[model samples]
Target chain A: MHFVDRVRQRLDDAELQHNLKRTRGRNAASRAAAVAAFPDFDAVRARATEIRARVLRDLDLWLEAFEAKATESGATVLWARDGEHACELIIDIARRHGVRTVVKSKSMVSEEAGLNAALEAADIRPVETDLGEYILQINDNEPPSHIIMPVIHKSKEQVSALFARVHGTAPKTDIEALTHEARAVLRPQFLGADMGLSGGNFLIAETGSVAIVTNEGNGRLCTTLPRVHVALTGIEKVIPTLEDLSTLLRVLPRSATGQAITNYVSLLTGPRHAGDPDGPEHMYFVLVDGGRADLVGSDFEDMLRCIRCGACMNHCPVYQTIGGHAYGWVYPGPMGSVLTPLYQGLDKALDLPQAATLCNQCSVVCPVSIPLPELMRRLREKQMEQGLRPWRERLATRLWAWAAARPALYAWGARIAVRYLRWLADGRDRIQVMGLAPGWTAQRDFPAPAGATFRDLYARRRQGRA
Target chain B: MSTRDDILGRLRRQLGRTGSGLAEARRRIRDEIDTPRSGPRPSPGDDPERFIGRARAMLSTVDGCATMDEVPAKVAGWLRAQGLTTRLVIAPAFAGLDWSGAGCEVRAGAAGPHDAVGLTGCFRAIAETGTLMLRSGADMPPVNSLLPDTHIAVVPRTCIVPDMETAWTHARAEWRHWPRAVNLVSGPSRTADIEQTIVLGAHGPYRVHLIIVG
Candidate 1:
């Protein structure tokens, strides 16, 4: 089935409706609180955009500085041209370290690179320590339903049952109890794992540091307790300095979870130094380009400014109705509509760019101001130019364009269509069983076209008409 | 070309930049980083009372201590009130604070999983966000503030910074060489991943109590 039909099916799923309603309510409150946290939100957004634009303009230099500084700070920096290269570097590290078990923090980059499968193929077990990710990991068929909240589609009762079946214990109905159960299970993994992998939120070029923001303490544990730490990050995550990092941090938590500050914001430079009590002994950074560089100076370069806060999806009516799984990709909502196609080819992900209503809510809520609707429109134009749309839709569009060029033919066509539609309506105001567009009239009636075209109505009014 | 050269070359091509432009960009970044300017930030009014108020509002219990000697009693009392164990793991940096009178069994080192409480002295506390800044060193290790179920931090009132920018200035001035880890912790470890309901202590300390010494 096509993406449209799948979305339509999911739009009516009872389980999905129940899940999305809860998220809508929670997101509404968080967005309100986030808006209230900042005295001058727009000014901060403008500055952030300027900083990102500067970084993107000189991305290669900043990356070079980052590599040099991080190496000086005792970290080994490696560059990967694509996801395959990134995965291979990580697997090779695992092999050399004799890593039997790996504990991972929540990282969208690892998801994009398909690192877990690669590690598994090499006989190394990877454990997801974040509670939401752990749930998705156990249920192999379910991808993350939301970026921040991976198990947004699941309920506590369902989680309870999953724990009981997977861990071989009686299901506990309390929410806190389930959380404690996950902590108990993942603690040993943290203590015993030879290596830990995480995604970088921002790689500071000045301090040779990686800034990670997480509400849960798993990020701190994953980066600290393991002997070897590997951070897989996109090239676009680099900032010029710690001062710049401070500005980005101010907006990130507010935009992400409405917190004045997240519980833990770790600025880790390299690994543990000599005489330091406890941290990773060695550190490695894999900077994955993966098609982001393709948009450096293009019209779509603005999309790279996204901080992955999930605010666009939280405010999107289309996404809230269909949920994230309907988008069928790593990213979802307005950001995903532009990114999925650009990152994973426009041919396979056509429905994503077409899914938006171009309401402009996403643009207003975006922390860095990406102009998402305009980008989506550009993607649609690109798709049409590439001849990726269906032939019937293309033919209809071309016919309308051709008729629209000549007013007399368009007026005549409109008059004939209204007359035929008046007969189809059978004297009723609406037509339920119409051949004009069965998809539109499938569940509800389409209103009859006022019984006269606009030109006819204007002429009749000029002639003292009814 | 190697992968590094290839990746950088592709970026240069897409961005329409020449080799000469690279030197200029590097210089600009270096100048900006050397002379840092603060950006638009929230003005929470950098005062001790406001800092304490904000810290309390974030669910962190803040108690005022007249001197360094008063920190142990407060930690012990808070622990007893909360029914936590009296066996505490103190950071080596804070080994001078007397814990004998507080009636608590104290050990100074990295925190273990079985340790219920860990105490440390913070580098600086920011008033803007009620955040405690901790730097990793021989004296103040990272795990002392993270691994334990309960974290009790002792903050000297003079070490409080007006905002995050001021904290950065202090950090640069004090540690010319940056520490391995610089943590800005605000409140206890928490998560909203479970059906968007906030649950405290997902993997770190469930309770974070602050003892402010004057």
Candidate 2:
């Protein structure tokens, strides 16, 4: 019910509809152009997929290597089995260090764990440093619609309104001015915060380092100025070696924002070493395993190979229409459809698995070549297996199966249904309304049947030939 | 079991691997890390001109310095040309550079917010993306390039790498034990978070000037 309500709200919001149209189109085209410009995209993509596949095969091994190396490099490695544990670890770290404020870069892992609220509950101010994230943070903690561009759901005027109301300045329509407003506000937060929290883009198992990719320099500041830096990432983010980072980076920025490389790609090992004047003195990595470990060696294991590029959603027709908030979770789009069902239980997100049109656009654009549509289909099958799909849908499917098993019955039912649908059309080619399946025709016209079943046509043609 | 053990245990169980060969797999992982594999990299041409072109593409100003002795004067001229202040926060590596010759007073240490320009030397100049790979240390604080409104890096031509893979290989051979942070900055900070429009200088340096020493 909540998901349906959110979908209705997003669909009815004209500004959001316009923005999603522009956002999805521009994002998809930019990614295509970026991929087109790269001459060796196919080969590099192959290498990237190979690297991810290797990690998936031995995820535990890669994680162990990373943990050991991180610890050796003076980073305290913490493991969490769930989101609650992850939040608790970070809060505990803040309490131990007497950290009153945390300057955080945009981290999806932290978002999943609800780290900001936890930090607030612990009496530590958590500042969102990314421009988009800052906008969402100040405006009642709006969840990001798109992972890459969190505020893409809102229009420019909306952001201007929010900024003017919050900063007590005149509403500035220009993005440059609005961006500068955020820069001015967050600079002091970066300079004064006691702890810098970031999400690891890739955890290099060989060197015990965490790589963070960002266009803005907030990631650098969050890790550099603060006395303590804490990187929270999923356990599946680990890679075997630093060389693999180069392979992933080759496609990551290009696929995400159409940049050959983001403005900053920082591979931070442990804390500042001896004789280092700046950078965090204490570095910690809390590797969260919330449902990720369960994904290993499962049917949906390939979902773990996702680089969080958001390309799947950028190209998803369903997402383009309904937007991410309609999915009702942290991750959205095709990847989120699979992830939400698996991570948050299928019964809760049954509509998500069926949200796609199976256009295969998502898989084609995926940097790591994750078969997202197939994954969503698998989620649907899982829902059916668990009896989580709607009872009517299940019954309809079973009745169809029973009819399909009997050739004569199937032909008879199909012929009658086709005639009835043709009559419903009343000589028109398109039916605007259908009594049996009104939901299908609610938004778009359904094509009228040609008044003949496949079996009838086949048998008549065969008899005439004989 | 402790949280760590429980997670590792679940992961191992899902992976269907027993603890019998943990030591062997560890050795293999270490070997894989040590023996570097060069993945496919875009052909970032190996030349100072190519590096300069790429750097410019990333929105950085690249000027050539014929010798290390002329670095300070060049920095001053560039700053004046850009209508910036002559006061600088220089990294410890540039302590001996003659700032007086350029008519500028400079402080040698970590950069501060009030500092208008931060000057430092780069570990490597990546030609692939026109990026500066900065290794943080006492002599070269990462904030020198971050905190200031303007960041100027003097890179030697010998320090240029064709791609990121080579940068790491070079870093491994050079740093031995890696520095705390290795930041690869392409250009000025920009964000497209608002309406997907890129606005430069979001929270870091508004300008990135690269002075290459041949």
Best by TM-score: 2
Tens-digit lDDT track for model 1 on A48-149?
888888899888888888999999999999888788889999999888888899999989988888888888888999999889999889877367867887
* Candidate 2 residue lDDT tens string, B132-205: 99988889988889988999999999999888788788877778778888899999999999878888899888
Q: What is the CA-based DockQ of model 1?
A: 0.82
Error at A68, model 2, angstroms: 1.1
Per-residue lDDT for B49 in model 2? Answer: 78
TM-score for chain B of all predictions: 0.95, 0.95
Question: Residue B213 deviation, candidate 2, in Å?
Answer: 1.7
Model 2, residue A273: distance off in Å is 1.4
Global local distance difference test of model 1 = 0.87
What fnat does each of the candidate structures reach? 0.86, 0.90
Q: What TM-score number comes out for model 2?
A: 0.96
Worst window of 10 by summed lDDT in candidate 1 chain A:
A23-32
lDDT of 1 at A330: 88
Compute each candidate's TM-score over C-alphas.
0.95, 0.96
